[model samples]
Target: MTPLLTYLAKVVIVSGILYGYYYLALRNNRFHQWNRYYLLFCAILSLIVPLLRIPLQFAPEETSNSYTGQVLLLREQVFTPAAAAEAGRTDWAFVLYSLVALLCVARVAWGYWKILRLIRHSRLEFIRPYWLVLSDKIGAPFSFFRYIFWNSDSRFETPEYRKIFRHEMVHVQERHSNDKLFMEAVTALCWVNPFFHLMKAELALIHEFIADKKAVAGGDVAEYAQSILQMALQSRHDFQLTNNFSHHPIKRRILMLTASRRLRFSYLRRLLILPLAAIIFCSLAFVVQEQQVETRAAQTAPADTIKPPPPPAPPRPNAKPAKPVFDSGGNEVFTFVEIPPSFPGGEAELAKYLSTNIRYPKEAVDKNLSGTVFVSFIVSAKGKIDSVRTVGTKKGGGLEEEAIRVVKEMPDWRPGKQNGRQVAVMFNLPIRFTLAKPEKKGPDGVYTRPEKMPSYTGGEGELHQHLRSNIRYPKEALDKRVNGTVLVSFVVMPDGSLKDVKPAGDKVLGSGLEEEAVRIVNIMPAWEPGREKGEAIATRMVLPIRFSFQ
Candidate 1:
């Protein structure tokens, strides 16, 4: 589920539990005012709880697979499972939910407009601290904000009308209309949630109970119950935002009105809500992002541990090299055997094998280098890899060593055969080492070019090596597994002294990461500063130091 969908699901679950508890424990009771507030609080809590995300982190279980192949594979873009899933498909469910929610909100607004228009059409009859809108179209007495909707044609006695007026006035004075409006909005947005509508229904009944109790504070309860029944006969569902005078199952209203069945110390039941809310906070408030150690390790190679191939042999002056013979008698290795040697499996396994075995050397990556190396080796009669040697003329810095290591550990192949007997045969595999180019930075108060660019002592490789060896992941950040790159900018001074070392770029990674990056660059030794027209001058340089656990 998308984040939005996850939130909606939580809302449904939380509201469902709260409403279920209310239905089972606190409905149609003497604590009418308390129940009304409880329902509203539940609605508010359900919506708010999902938003509080407390992230919990755990170290992933470690796993390993030993491989025997040497081709390092790197893709330019690395997508996590969530990102890939989001990229490949549309969240039509969330889209539909949003559309329906918007329509529900529109309906809420439209309901309010209808009520307002009715109030406009019917002239107000002020009866001291209460405004009444008498309209035949409105079949029942309902309160919207301040105005009370009333039928212009009267069906009740004068005394009953006064009682009804008092009942509607209770809704207005206690701001019960606000509670109705709030629940109506909630029910509209979560129209699919039966509990929200049910909660709204329970709330409306509570509102009527509250008004009935107040309207009959000193008067006769039997007459008040009779008035309720008379109004219920005429009432029907109208504007959802309005507080109807007789919105209910008439029997429950009459029963609650006459019965003295209020639970003693019923407020104690309210204590249950606290613990239930705590349970919700403990369970639904957090998200566990399971990041397995194996998966994270697979996501990125530990370049620090990878050793590159040694440089190619230099030319020897006035020297002759000796070659080893195939056997006791000198013989040449055959290129074409009756049956060619094969890997344990076919090409697909061979590719997987190579990918599994090889990891790009940190040296080459640090220097932004990439190249293809052709390797030649012999598959002997015993299916053992023998006489491995690099064939390519172009030497890829540090790449050949990793490729060589991979080939040496490969599983024994199916030996080649000549005529009807096994014989020595040669095989050549071409593997490429590639690195994605880092983003190039633009000039930031620094020279883009000079007569001679500044160079760190021991060159590019050593500078990166220094950073890798000395820089430490900040303890606070490492504990939280916050991974990112901090780009550092500094000026190499005229006297080969460093100055103005600070983090560069618009993206300032906090958590002391940028501070850590800047600190390491600051501690570095002086460099050979850039010179313009035979004069040494300070030049700005950008270095991006990436800290990652995956």
Candidate 2:
């Protein structure tokens, strides 16, 4: 699954457990303050736990192909084919998710705007530590942060008015607006998650329960309950960031107020949160174990396995003497040769020639395919290219055909040298196909040189630590002895979000190794965005991760 989907799943699981615990054990208990704090803490914890990765260390396994002489060249090339008339596909799921989230944010913003306008138009009066706003437009009393809005029609001299004021005071003094604001932001981001909305409603009810308990202390509890019932019948605007006196169900508030406090020992039931948190941590830190048995079996295989017979000798008696040749498995065999092979001129000339002659296939262009293709061939003793074939271009789509055709068309190269004579030698060449284009500019604008370069939360060392802890080596790669470095490139947006993650070069080690590298990169937390001239800007970055069994 993608990282976003995985995070959403974790949120659902954690929220479900917390909500279930609240409903069964703590709903009717008299620990209203404890319940209020628990909901806020759990909500924040659910978002954080998914990002905590725990590293697991194991002894390195031995492998046969541990030679380090073979050089691996990493080449990155971008291709943008001439714009074709292909129909564009719409990402409906992303569109729907973004639209819903925007609507939720707008709804929250509108509520805040209404509250601010009410404060602006109403008469402000000082009531002890609280600033009271007398608004004739407001139908019910509510408290937001340090400001309390009172219905202008209510008589301040009455006993009922005094009781309502006490309830609003509890909300302000305890900072209930902080909890509401946090939950409101959560709801806006995850509007599609019905659980968040349900949690929000439950938290509002908890706030009311806490305020009701404080309001009735050392006073007539029965009379206070009657005032709550009367206020519930009045019209009220349900602002998300405010604590409204009569917003919660009237019966639940009155019942909670009158219920006997649970035994102090029963409060230990809250300890259930500890075990629930542990389960969540373990689930998020899941790791895949390497297949030791298969690795052992491979290590024990016989070295003297059946091998192919030697190639037949040349028919001409006067032909040049044969020289040693290495098979694909690196095993030595005799072949007609003399000198080792070399490209005409030198390595520099070979690169220049390939770049000058290679053509991007029209078929590949139409499909927007771009990558490197590795071509392997034999440089004959006569300095002629023959037996030309492609080693890997697993991204087929006519790319392999184009690479092979270019190799066959090359002029004769310098003959190989073996035992002071010309000989045939194997040669591997990688040709890249790219459509020339300019660097991409992000929505907020791209930065070529930034005052502060983007980095992981801690530093580059922490990024490596994160990758080492989270990357899961593919089992197929281990069994086949496929190991190499995979280069991944991504764009860090101005808002510190990652986008356009992809492999920077052709896949060197197949068997899902490259895919695993890309997955790990995608799951990384956003970096500190780069800044240019004191403003955040998008910057592209490339990272290489190596996979090895030994």
Candidate 3:
């Protein structure tokens, strides 16, 4: 699911739970005095957990695929009997099922642990007049019990204290402890729902409002405020389960209590109906998402069914040169061809440049534009860049414009050359707009570019002779069982020399192939390196050396 949708779903689920809590609380009284913010915070955390969990679910499988695709294939092969013993075992589906099961177990265990801790800390305290109260020593209600009255050394005869006591009494008489336990349990279970915490907070607030109204209906508000302040000052942490007469934030409680309005039963009834509607809608949305995912998977099955093409054949060491080649053949072939390199720079440089030059077209930034744009074109024979196109990953006009504009301003390249002349070659580049780590700076504050190397000017016949004499293929590659290409990039220096031999492409062809190609290239008979403006400077080049069995 998209991040936006993921967030929305979390919000809705949490909200529903809160609304449910509020509805139930209202059933007891119209003006209850409680701290709603506390509950809201709890629900918010719960919501975030589940949303974050969704992405992590696929992490193990993705890592496995990246680290060892062969292992995954092997698992699929060896476990066929057991897999066949079960039903429905598509790779992705199996992975998803495992993820879901893991998440469920983790979430349940975490939630149970949290609630258990809360219950333990809220040791039940039996007090006077056959009343029970749960307190965390912060004057907040830990559970339902009789009205608790303890603040200062001196017992106050204030009307506010009386009202507060009455509020606690209401909680005790109505078994508010049980209701709270239920609410917390639900909130814990739905921790991934941001709205859950919000709803819980709302419920607590409404509950407070109801109790406050009942207390103030017959007396003075000023006295109640004074009593709350006094109790708060003298509150002790020793109380655990006893319901406290003095709860804070006292100001919020007072405001809620004073605003409490006697509403008709019909109003609450209407609210109940709305929650039912919301629940149904959310359920439907979830179901639709599931169906869409299944449909997409079905559509993708055919595409994946197209087995990977057999790896390309390795170039023969002593074979005749292929005709119809772009560059010259025997006596004119180059051991190395150089292509100019370009970089937008390290993170800091990019940030600095963007800060000063990136105008982000206010509209695009306002709309929060983000995407990866793939720009592919050719570097001309003379190293000039052209045909820059922006293919958007998401539908954002401004983002495309910014990307295209930036690409157009890129510095000219020292075009790719082959044999003794330049040649146009296709290049693919990906530009991404994302929050990433800053580039690291070395001690001396120097940014080093890859060193340039010389190019070769020799015939294909000479190239073959050199390769046959020096190349040493890995045992595996020579075994004719591995069919893969090794793309190597090395420098051919000014005076018929090879330096900085390296692999410039995929490693799937096997690291062995790459090393063999590099070794052969390094020892090959050198060619005259390409020159620029009568000066022979080091050049950069890429070469694809392939190995195959058939």
TM for every model, in the order presented, reads: 0.51, 0.53, 0.31
Worst 10 residues of 2 by lDDT: 294-303
Backbone clash total, candidate 2: 13
lDDT of candidate 2 over 1-550, digit per residue (tens): 4346767887887777777877787767778788888888778877787766543323232212221111122122222343212112344766787798899889889999988998999999997777999977877899999999988888989888888888999999999898898899998998766677887888899899988888888898899998888788866656768999987688989998888865565757888778877887787765433211110011110011011112222234553432445544443322222223445544444555555555567888778777767676776667777777876537667888877887789888766544555655555455555554533353456553355667677653356356545666565654455556566677778888888888766556688867886788789897788777788888776665555432
Q: Which candidate is the best by TM-score?
A: 2
Q: Give the local distance difference test score of model 3.
A: 0.43
Tens digit of per-residue lDDT, candidate 1, span 1-550: 4556667788999999998888877876688877888999999999998887564544322211111011211111221223323444665886798799899889889988887788888868986667878887888788877788788897556888888888888889989878878888888787777888888888888888888889888998898888778877867877777778777788898888887775865877777888998999888777653211000011111112111112223324643333323622234455433345666543444655665457766667667767667666777788888877786465566677877788889899766655567777666566656553222223453453555677778664466456545666565654444555455777777887878888765676687888877787788898887777897876766554555432
Q: Give the local distance difference test score of model 1.
A: 0.66
The true-structure Cα RMSD of candidate 3 reads 23.5
lDDT by residue (331-368, candidate 3, tens digit) is 22211233222222222233333333333445544565
Sorted on TM-score, best first, the list reads 2, 1, 3
**Candidate 2 deviant stretches above 4 angstroms:** 61-89, 286-550
Off by over 4 Å in 3: 1-129, 132-143, 146-160, 233-244, 260-550
Better of 1 and 3 by lDDT: 1
Model 2 gets an lDDT of 0.66
